[model samples]
Target: MKQDNEAVGAQEESFSGDESQSLVPDANYQEEFSWFSVILPFLFPALGGLLFGYDIGATSGANISLQSPELSGISWFNLSAVQLGLVVSGSLYGALLGSLLVYPIADFLGTEEEGTYHCSCTIPSWGLITAYAPDLGVLLVGRLLYGLGIGLAMHGAPLYIAETCPSKIRGTLVSLKELFIVLGILLGYFVGSFQINVVGGGYMYGVSAPIALLMGIGMWLLPPSPRWLLLRAVQGKGSIQELKEKASFALSKLRGRPPGDNVSERQIEDTLISLKSSYADQESEGSFLEVFQGPSLKAFIIGGGLVLFQQITGQPSVLYYAGPILQSAGFSAASDATRVSVVIGLFKLLMTWIAVLKVDDLGRRPLLIGGVGGIALSLFLLSAYYKFLGGFPLVAVASLLLYVGCYQISFGPISWLMVSEIFPIRTRGRGISLAVLTNFGSNAIVTFAFYPLKEFLGAENLFLLFGGIALLSLLFVMLLVPETKGLSLEEIESKILK
Candidate 1:
């Protein structure tokens, strides 16, 4: 009996060693990645995408009601563009706050120490907020705080997904996060449309905000990443098995695992040890500042510039003010514009779904080329519509929908996917954060400036400018963006440097 027990122990040790080797195996990680392994890592990050999309789209729908002529007397619309900008930028402000604090929070929440969070659900308890209660001032404050909450949640989601996932499916998973983001937008638009059409626009706000809160609360169903669990869970602090159980539950939705069957104790221990070792290797990889100091310049340029080009696509311009843009083009009032914009949102959701499904099979560059080409074509037609016919309202409308579809299928998902793929694991969180921040910063800038630019440049020139940028982006992708369809993170990293 003693001999039998000893043999079992030996087999476990051997399994651990083999798993460890697999974690940083010297050669091609691409060939080894499987679907089961790739999908589970995306669960939380995808939720972050959902939150971003939902919150942003919810606002678009809610804005129509918020800014309606009937409610113009309300304090919400009493403020100037600066104040409204503050309100509109409130979430981004929260996101910035969250971004500032995410690393530490992730360290604390995700770390295995005794006081740290061992379960995913614990975060919402910390993030519990009441942004929509009474006063306009209170609601604004709450919204800013909610943005921070989302910011805190958003940073961790993609970082976790990128690091935990293998490269073969990394692009797909990262893109899934973006897809969920678009989904949230579509859902918010759909829900808001129904609410606004049925009741007043303010009712739309009333309906959507609480829904976000409820979803935030639902996050607890998943386990802490097993990587976080074994590496950071305190001794007697968290049941590794509990984390595994919860992770199995959370991961089940993404990968179709039965609640408890997906993760085992041995798998938890192995992944954790692998992450710890990977973390150690990461420590020596390079400093975030130092990452861009030397031979990494080419990569830094690509990563940074790609994000900039992503914004230049004029996608957010369409999203943030789609209804307004449509209305300006003669679509009726803001409410009708929103209803039509929802159709655009639906197109975005469907195309994004297509992108996610085919990204692995179709390859990144082709999608990007196709997307950029489509954006140029759509924008050119749109500019002509605006220039020739007082923005031939109907054509403007159709072009906008096509623009959204083109973006979702190409730049939207691939941008995030490539950002994750292009950077090294050691600097991945920081690198991806830099890329995401650039994305938001550019988004905020363009969003605020689009109105002004349209005022100054006129609608035709505004789109032409974006179309020109899209052309430049096409050139950039053709020249620099590497084909990363089947490569693992490490393999991609090696090839990029070589």
Candidate 2:
């Protein structure tokens, strides 16, 4: 009895000691900004975003170069319009397959980290194949392989941003994927403008591969996701001591505390347990059909529909043939039309940067609505200039710039942002893959069928059709697309459920 009393006394003293120490931190403990906390975690994963940007940009120039009639007499194999369309669009569908089919298994088989590395490595190799291919058949095969890499990176990059970033800055980081994409496109144009063959023929394709490989190498230096590390602990995969140490570091990084910061072990342990419980709740609530059953279905509709609308706004058509379209409208000189394309690409870069900064501030739905509405008006003006007035070049040019600006600020970035935000964890991978597939599928249709569309509707009338789609897209945003600004994933899911 005396020994038991002594032990009880020791326990009480230890408890009191812990109570005296502020586990959560003192009121005055200054939390200096840590790169490891905010930037490192978000930045490295976004290397995938950069790779994605490079691939999209590479094709814009390369596909055009490959389709040149002059290439017909070159040492390279002969080309036809049909083969050209296949080369340009073949990658898009390859991307569709990569996203819908590959991501699920890639994600299942390894960590997002491992899956990301796999995608990155393949992208560059595909670029090399396209560069040296002897014939159109081989070239199409290269683009397809390239598309597969693009599909995985496109899907995985944003997903990483969504999963890893803190909510306050999540929009900025995820939307940065779009920013990289635009930047790559702009850079690609620079290289291709002087000599499309110089950049497009072999060198630029080869260059992009090395850059992707570098980013893949960088991926290993960053920490695995805090949530995934915690999940491992819950599943009892690693030794208890090992899991605790790693989890402690991740939790510290997430909370913006330094290694020597005065956080208690108990606090770290509590957070791990809380994560386990939260993950359990997410897993238990959904069955196989649950994604299609309830509010999840609503999320699917909004996400999928948004991408479809984004494409139908004629973004792909304009991008694929900016120079041709401008020339057709009245800028008969190729030099003048190319200048306009340069202006448009630069403008797109600027607006999307604005979006990256203001997305969380302006909110998602407002931008989508405003952007689409502006697109409709701009397209209408362009059509009016072409059809009713017999081509006022100045007015048409201004309208096209306005249309591109609105798109950059609105659908181009926001559509991607929403796809990252809308789905539940269980369906996030598959849901996003489906949305990406829709993105490429629509891109393929617009790109391949544009010639026939122009033949059927005429150029002026085509702008009008695009205008109508933009206006209708505005309605879609208003009716659907819940506001996701500043909400936790759970809170966002709850809104969808309601």
Candidate 3:
């Protein structure tokens, strides 16, 4: 251990002496851009996000179908409003459990392997169970299992994308995960529209099974994160030379370069030194408590706060209950409401694309502040329509559309993107897991409480409260969130976190 400390000290001195090279591996070296290189790695991991979105979209219609008299023959089909909320929000509670479960084990498991486990195991199991379930108890169990997969996937996917992809396009790629999420939602709405009349919504719950199986198979073809390999090495998983050899190979695969590439070799050395320096003061790898101290605490504040606001402002509740909300707003027929949800889904998809294209170019804070302000305005408009203009249902529809569009641009994508960006790599897994736990925890609360709250406060008052939260969120972004447009992860830690 003493000798290891000496070697790390020497490497740090060599790293600091080099004035031309920045701490970020990508900052010092520029590889020729390859769309294939970038997109191939991103595609499989993003399926995790798609599954998350599909759950939201499919459940929206399922909520409607469960209320139909056709299935009322099932013993447990006739549910109270509170029981119905539990049925709707079951996966979210499971997601909260999944996030907590993964926190301590994330570093040990690594992101790539976690993806494979969730996709192959939890996701498919839930689909099969939910599809064939004959009772409400069985259905809730299946949804809870599925939520466990979502918790794992959501935590791993963004971290994998951010760490492996080129920094220049980091924001764009991470934001694209949001694109997949909305795409899944759109696909779910389409499926729900066709299957709304089908008893039990079996096909709707079963759709993700085959896709998840394929994604699990595809995950085997992708390389593990290079940074994760180096981190493990620093934790004494292997020798220094082994760390170099393994990390260099992973970097070559990620960057579409030859195994013997000199640039990849240099990056491995630099990253190792950086990792060592981060661990210099510690006796072991970062503990969960480490996430609460100093720089990691700051990251948690920003990342956690964003995700908290993301849910408390009511995005999940709106999407999960879209069919019911629209029906209440004047599209009395379930079919009409599901069709309108498709339109809303399409507009959301389009708006997310704008963020995907512009996140790297326009920076983070401006988009967040602007888009959140729009969200607040739309929420207030929704409240006004419900309160005083109940006669005009079109106003409610327009306001709902505006709310969905604005959220797609800002809070929907940016919140996750920033969470993946803000943490130091050493404690990144724990930090992000905690943030996601907060997210799903908040989501479960809002979703489960929606019906009761709507009944108690009325739709207008509920929306007005959400609008007030949105205004507070906008203020939080302006004052606290920093612009992370183009910085590399190491640069973010050394510069921004400091």
Candidate 4:
């Protein structure tokens, strides 16, 4: 322990004179900022979020399409309730499997390569397979493959965005990932509306294929994360001086500065010292066991808990079955229900934009706590409409919109944002992989059980249970989650984790 402290001290002492001054932002540094450079890198990684959202939106309509007799010419296409649940949740189960598979390999691959591989490979493959599947088994295989990509994208995008962005704008950039997801959902809804009667939902399933291929190509054009380069240096992938040169080049590009500029060089040197200090007392690479000890353990508890609640409070089930849920609330026509979903998607996009604007300014806790409080209230309103106000269909619609809007501001984006922020550099990859695993595992369970649970508990009682969970989530944020707005990754590790 004493030796560890000494190592940290030595690392800190390496920064001197102008190098130390670079740690504090100056007017010239502010003037050098290029929004286009920063936003360009962020845009490619965020397409992963779009893929996840498109699946959610397209599947909602696909569920309705699969129920029609036109597609039921195949004996198995006329699915029982249990079989239908499996079809709707097949991707989620695949996502669960994908998260477990990615846990050990996350550190080795890094986020950029992971994003590129999954987009270029998994997404297009799933789209083609699902679009032309001959039977239930084939369709399900396609869903699982698509879901595998979602798990990878969901794990990598936020972490990449968080690491590459300037700290002052980090919250906004990271939150834009959720914005892309919402846009995808909206796009999916529009396509589903047009393709609802198409045989076997082929058009709906195939639409994202070309777009995902384009995104994969774009990923190749962006710079790698500077922090990831530094991590490779710490892991002894190459000589320290050689890796530092590469890291400096990447950082200069990200900061929109000339590589040889004095300010850029000082900033890179300061970043290196901060990263080394963060890693000083730990092993060059982190192990699964190490993640459960001390500060990493605390980070897991916070990150894991947020993701757990994010699903259990019922966001996935609500979005996944929105068309049917709206139908039950008295939009009797299937087309009318899908149209309502598009409107709801638009509201969700707007709400996520509000969060992107306010997150760095208002801090994480306020949005989490306040939005959760609203979520609980919305759930209760839904329960009331189902139980005693059955005649008032509009009340249920209003409550559902409220729930989606509140969630956009709270658990929807913030949970992933916090997960990206909390872990130490060494264990961040595995730590976040575990959190994503927890997220998908719970989502699969909740989504698969939504039909049965609603049947058993009734819509009123199930919503009430979700309302209770939302209240508990609100309490969790108030008591345990810290405000991380405006802090650098190194500062967060030293102050919050310690």
Candidate 5:
């Protein structure tokens, strides 16, 4: 009884000691600038998504802008569907190559000290990185290379941010990628339409490429993911003090302390050691295939299926071709239709911000089900309007806008947050990459098929197809995916798989 009392006293002392230690200094950033810190990390993930949005939006919009005299001299005008496919899928194909190639580069390019601990294990060693051979005959080789970078950054960035940041801000931060996606779409639509009547030079007239370039360069300024550093150090048993400082900066922000608090040599060593013991074989770790081994398999299915659901809603079809879509419904001219599409993109951006603000309070499953369910109902109504009334194109357009609003509030940003949270640290990068690649592939299929579907089944049936898919996705989310809002990655992994 005396010995038990002594042990209990020691445990109490340790708990009290940590609790008494201030979470922050006198000048706590979290107290004064809490909102900014919450919103800022969210922006980082979106940087890559923004580029993706631009590439997607620009291809169609830029193509339309190129038909005039200013662009008539440019060779891009004579491009065929194969060429168009190259232009459209350039970023996606780059993403695919990057997705496969990142494992090796992330695995072997850097030692355990460079904030890429798992790189030594997760990456495969073939030169599949060059699968995006610049000589693919597209004139936009630079854009393709840029796309490769975007793919790498997009896959790695969110995982890095999600792992490093505290549980308090994780959802908001991951959702930022979604915001950037919407922003990029808006920016692309705006830039592409700016001088639509100006001909060739007009399409190339503005800062789309420059903006993408600037954004890519800007990402370098953000801190390397701390988890990457800890994982790397686990392999070599050597500490990288610089990497530790970066990790400290991130943790400091989360704990409401200074940028370097809890970042001492002892802390670094402890973190690395814990990660090493937890992951067991960092090299044989994080493969897309490995996610199916045990609990990870369930997590993978949830992550991949959620993303697949996000795509099946036909949201991309509405987004990618909103201009022509509105024009088809007899809205003003093509130019006006494009302008309205830009407005819709803006609306998406606005709604996404609302999501960031409220996601934690509202919870993930609720928003997801509500968003998809609402959109499904709206799509069905729009189909009815189109079938019954000749002048119901405006109704269709209004319903589409509402659908974007629903998606923006729910699956648009929530899916990314949920995927980032669900996977454990060991398989995080590969798991999320698989989700992203699945999203892109499904997006590509949906984007390509929508036109053919409309052509074959007519507009009414096309919407019915989307409505049914949305309803099915909603049911799946309710039945399978549990709510993950406000949970830490560790808590989520342990609770979810169990």
Candidate 6:
């Protein structure tokens, strides 16, 4: 890659820019990044991603046992249709509430503090309650709370990576959290599948408790976000030298700069300038409405619009109701149909792993366009197979695998990565919250509409609808989204808002 050293120190108008100072990193800064430092944030915080994914897969995977009178999935496995609907969708509704709360949480209590509370304490508490709920209503409440916790975690996890990670590999690092999500889902599937009859089928719901509790404790020990500590350092509440020391220590750990003794004198000075500039960019604390106006609007559109297309790609529908979809296509045995979900979980986990590796190398734009274009074609073929051919089970399976592959690689991970990347730090919490709101909003629409569409148009025409959306998404990426590979956060803002 060519050098843009000159661009770093140049001042530009910014919503969350460091204090009018030129604090660009030296071009070679990334070369000295430590592997240990780079991986720790993912290890400590990305566990939250695992917990979130686990909740999603755990509920759907356990649905099989819950419906099975022979197993202990749900004590009220024989509930009425209306009751079952509530049981299943309770968490998603909670997630919507959590996503919408982001702006208020940031404006009032602050995202840094609020995120810790949601992830560590709220999640574990809800998981345990859901695990041991005395009745269906209690279980529903627990599930709803679980959704709220993970919804907040989803916002916090990616935003943490976006802020801590250097721009050179931010997409890849952030996307890695997406893989942990699928891995958690995969674990939930297998865990529930193995102990189908365990604890009255409450195993899946309760399993997250220990993990979340551990995560809750781990968060207390980890340092607060450097950006956040800087934000708190407003109006000389403390010494500027002290803020720089803390920021440098945390940033060095996250970005992997050498220790003060080992770093070159000039590099140390440049690092301080960059840190100061970043702190300077923080918006005076207020409502998040500022980003919705003026130059920031472009960034918001790209962020929100990207997640909208991601949801419309039909992933939530597939995840929530894979059993019925599989059985409809030809897997007649209920146990077989349920087990196939395990296969789907594994497939998603593996493909997303590949995406974690490739996102940095190929850049975000090519992967988004390529993966979604493949998804569009797969959806069209799957629709035709279900509609016209009717009896070819293997064909349906193959098409589904192809669709899953395309989705995991493209829309699945990149959407989250871009959400964290595109927004400036000033409104990042709210920006990502809005994008997540878009994601959950689209997911809710698709999830609710899938059954109705299936009833009226059948699976064939329904998928054709998704196929059309996927095609539109391709055009959206091609024309509107920029290639954000290897650019610093401030540089990206400068380029996009220029």
Residue 470's lDDT within candidate 1 is 92
List the lowest-lDDT window of 10 residues for candidate 1: 111-120
Each model's TM-score, in the order given?
0.77, 0.82, 0.90, 0.90, 0.78, 0.84
**How far in Å is the alpha carbon of 399 misplaced in model 4?**
1.2
Query: Local error of candidate 1 at 372, Å?
Result: 1.4
Which pairs, if any, clash in model 3? Answer: none
Give the winner by lDDT: 3 or 6: 3
Candidate 1 local distance difference test against the native: 0.61
Question: Which pairs, if any, clash in model 4?
Answer: none
lDDT of 6 by residue, 64-109 (tens): 6677777754457786655655666677677788888765765444
Superposed on all Cα atoms, the candidates' RMSDs to the truth, in angstroms, are: 7.4, 7.8, 4.1, 3.5, 7.2, 4.6
Give the per-residue lDDT digits (tens) of candidate 1, residues 1-498.
344333322322222212323334575433333365455445544656676786667667666666665643344555555555555556666666666665434545651221112112223321232223344566566566666656656666765664345434455566778878888888778766666554345444444344444444434443444444443432335675675555444333333445444233344455544444444423423455855754255666777788788887787677876767777789776667778878888888889899989988889999989988988888887788888966467888878877888888778888777776676544555665666567766766776676667878988899999899999999999999889877744556566644
Question: Candidate 3: where is the Cα deviation over 4 Å?
Answer: 1-29, 71-75, 239-244, 259-263, 486-498
* Candidate 4 residue lDDT tens string, 242-272: 8778767776687688885676566667667
Error of 2 at 215 (Å): 1.4
Estimate, for each residue in 300-358, the C-alpha lDDT of model 3 and write its tens digit. 99999999999999898789988888897899887888999999999999999988888
- Global lDDT of each model? 0.61, 0.65, 0.81, 0.79, 0.60, 0.69
Candidates 3 and 5 compared by lDDT, better number: 3
When sorted by TM-score, best at the front, the candidate numbers are: 3, 4, 6, 2, 5, 1
Error of 4 at 426 (Å): 4.1
* lDDT, residue 85, model 5: 47
Cα lDDT of model 4 overall? 0.79
After aligning candidate 3 to the native by TM-score, how far in Å is the CA of 2 from where it should be?
Answer: 23
Which lDDT value does model 6 have at 302? 89
